[model samples]
Target: MPAQVLAPAPAVTPPRAGRGYWRRLLPALAVLACLTRVPSFTRPLWNPDEGYLAVQARILAHGGQLYETVVDRKPPLVPWLYEAAFAVTGSGSLTSVRVLAVLAQLLTAALLAALARRRWGDRAGRTAGVLYLLVSVGLNPEDAQAAGFEVFILPGTAAAMWCADRRRWTAAGVAVGCAVLAKQTGGAVLLPVLWLCVTSGAARTAAPRLAAGAALPVLGAALLTDPAGFLFWTVTGSTAYAAFSGSPLHALTRALGNAGLLAAACAGLLAAVARAPRAASADLWLWLAASAGAVLTGFHFFGHYYLQLLPPLALLATAALHTEPWARHRTAVLVSACACAVFLTWGLTAPRAELTHAQRVAEAAARRTGPRDPVLIWGMHPETYWLARRAPASRYLTAGLLTNYSGGRDGARVGERYAVDGAWPVFRREMTARAPALIVDDSRGKPYAPAHVPTLRRLLTDRYRVVGTVDGAVLYARVS
Candidate 1:
């Protein structure tokens, strides 16, 4: 018989308490995130939707209904969220909104850190949190200037990521509900939810969780803000205009644009997943869902739609870096540093709303005029008129469609095409009736609202004589 020597019991090192560390760490990270995200918040509120959403929030806080006052046909989640922020902050100023978006980004980063720790352990999560802070430029409420929809989608999707990974159907459903209520693009989670519904362990557990989770929106609607006009916006407001995502064939064009590198990356991920079936389920879900969102947004939606993918892509990128660092076992730190740098650069340089000197000059002109002044802004943010503490000149507003929102045929088409093709005829009519006294149209973002995205129709330029030029914006006065 081989003598088996009894091995001495291994000594276990006592775990250190994290209370002190967490106490010191959280506020520092939060301050860092706030500093980066709040600088140019005014940029996002400048977007049309932000103005709409902000108005709705103010209305909601005053216990007002949406359809009665605002063009709020969508779900009331965003307004209510804004209301809560407003209540706590006691201000309806856009500054409060920017603060909320920054806070949301911070919380989102914290949640991502939690998810990362569960998947990759403590170190990676902390690293991800720091990275999130450093690169959270667009995650702030100021993002409303660019597109608040993406920020709205992040929290719920991140929650969904957490719940799905834990195989908690109800939790995922709740997250999905909040997301959907926040923004329409959140419906993108349908694919992953379906995947969860089909799996075995998920079969029994997922349904009830889903039902419970669904109650959030219903509850929000009943107990909170009731946006009865939501359906109207979904059916009418959303499609009233043609999408500007690089045109109809944009999907094919963008796909082909990055065909070589994208294909290789997807192929690589697919193979790796196939080989590692036992890998962390949360990580896999994050990667696949994000990849799906990227492909869907890139191929299906307009370039602006890329805003939807920021959070997930952030997580996916973090996870990929974490995994690769382990495999390569060398230069992991260097690679992470480089990735952080890239993210920071992207955050800082992402396409955002900005007012040029010309815009400022037009603003000055608008200021020179009073609310009683016939301030015609055919091609600019009408709010500039309102904000300068002035009012607009006419009832016919230049927006997505040329439909008669008030009444009468107005001899203009209603579909989204009105801006792209219908604008010339409509502008001619508006010029005939009430040419704007002032105009401020961008060379980017909503500038293309009337002119279409990617390129503006120079033909529309013929209707207006340039009163002033600001940055990429051209302020127009009706050519007599």
Candidate 2:
């Protein structure tokens, strides 16, 4: 028989990567690029959402339980992050908090680039990183600016996705666990990450490892620190959040409108996924569904909620922009770029609610009150309390609890009680016992009203005197 010779096995070519120098420098450049927001980092806290977290962080730093001393309908992870920041650089320094925030954003951007590069190509990786930085920093409104919980969630989610793609199942689980700790919705990433492990034939081993890795931070924090606090805030307390925020349909409309370029790119991404190889497409589609579920879970789709979708969406968009024919890629890029440009322009130029006014208000309050003096803000400006480093007089930091207790129009609709009306007596008792040294009423241009809670009305009338006014804030000093 003629000697049978096997043809030389086809040589495999490693995918082309950035040139040596570019590879070394790109990630560094991405980090530096994200840090450009350093200028805005030291600005005073203005938005209530950030202020709420900041205040809770301050509380934690001062030996307060996550839910007992301060209350919110979210998880404890963000408060812990803020507490850590306070420990590192002294509590209530806008610069300290913002610096930590910048670092988080930078880390997230770098991880996003790594994920894009590994899944797509070097060019897509760089593009995705740059895109995320711009969209996150530039496109976010003032309310969602610098250290938002959503920003914090990004790095963890991106890390999870990146590790899962590389089959680092345990690390992926840990990363996602961190994300979930940051925000309750972070658990959403768990589905896709475990799915990847199972489909890749590592389910038996990877699943347990992933579960253990994920449970470490959460379980450790819960058991060692505050189990009841975590359970109430993250799960039970959050039940009423959706009812008061907005309907799912309304949230969907607002999310699409605010998401801007990202929404459009997602449409293109769907098309790209449809045309992709079956295995890869399956992963991408599952990821998208998982992200969408996370965003929609509370049925109050805040713009930041859509952020969790960015990594998968960015990957798919990059594929549509670069992996396809020139004509289609060009059209996709142009449409996305144009929409992104419009959103970016608006975000950059849209007049932001100035914190200077808020800072001035907080400074005035700080000057009037002593270190241990309890300060009360009647409205939603928790930032004032955080900036002044003054402890809140009552467990209910903002009036949302008080106003929503009786089924106010602003909350769970007319006649549908949002909070237990039974809590009103407790609210009255807490405020009366605390007897806040100074009350800063922020009605957001409306006259402060204590009508909602009769106890507040009595306290305002009998126990407090209007000491001064700082812009829209009416400062009341305890008199009786």
lDDT of 2 by residue, 1-480 (tens): 111111111212245534662566466655555444544454555366788888887787777876676777676777777888778887746576666667776777777666666666666666566555544543345534556777777788888877887778889888988998888777777877876777767679888989888988788767755787767767776565545453445665666665664555344344654564544545555777888888776465556677777666666656555566767755554555555555445545555454665677789889999999998888767787877878888777777665642111242342114453445667667776787899887764432256545566778889889888987678889995
C-alpha positional error of residue 409 in candidate 1 after TM-score superposition, expressed in Å:
23
**lDDT accuracy of residue 292 in candidate 1:** 60
lDDT of 1 by residue, 1-480 (tens): 111111111212223634554566578668766665544453434454554465456555656665443443346677666767778876435667666667677777777776666555566566556655543432222332342556666677767766765667777888888877776667676555645465534466667768678666755664443333455554445453323333435456544544432322223232333343232344445445654664463234333344444444445445555566455322333443454444344445555444344236446656545545555444435344434543334332334433322111122333334443233454455445654455555434442344442222442476656666555556566555
lDDT of 2: 0.66
Best candidate according to lDDT = 2
Model 1 stretches with alpha carbons more than 4 Å out:
1-25, 38-52, 55-65, 72-75, 79-93, 131-147, 193-202, 222-228, 235-237, 240-304, 314-354, 357-365, 368-376, 380-386, 390-398, 401-480
lDDT of 1 at 451: 48
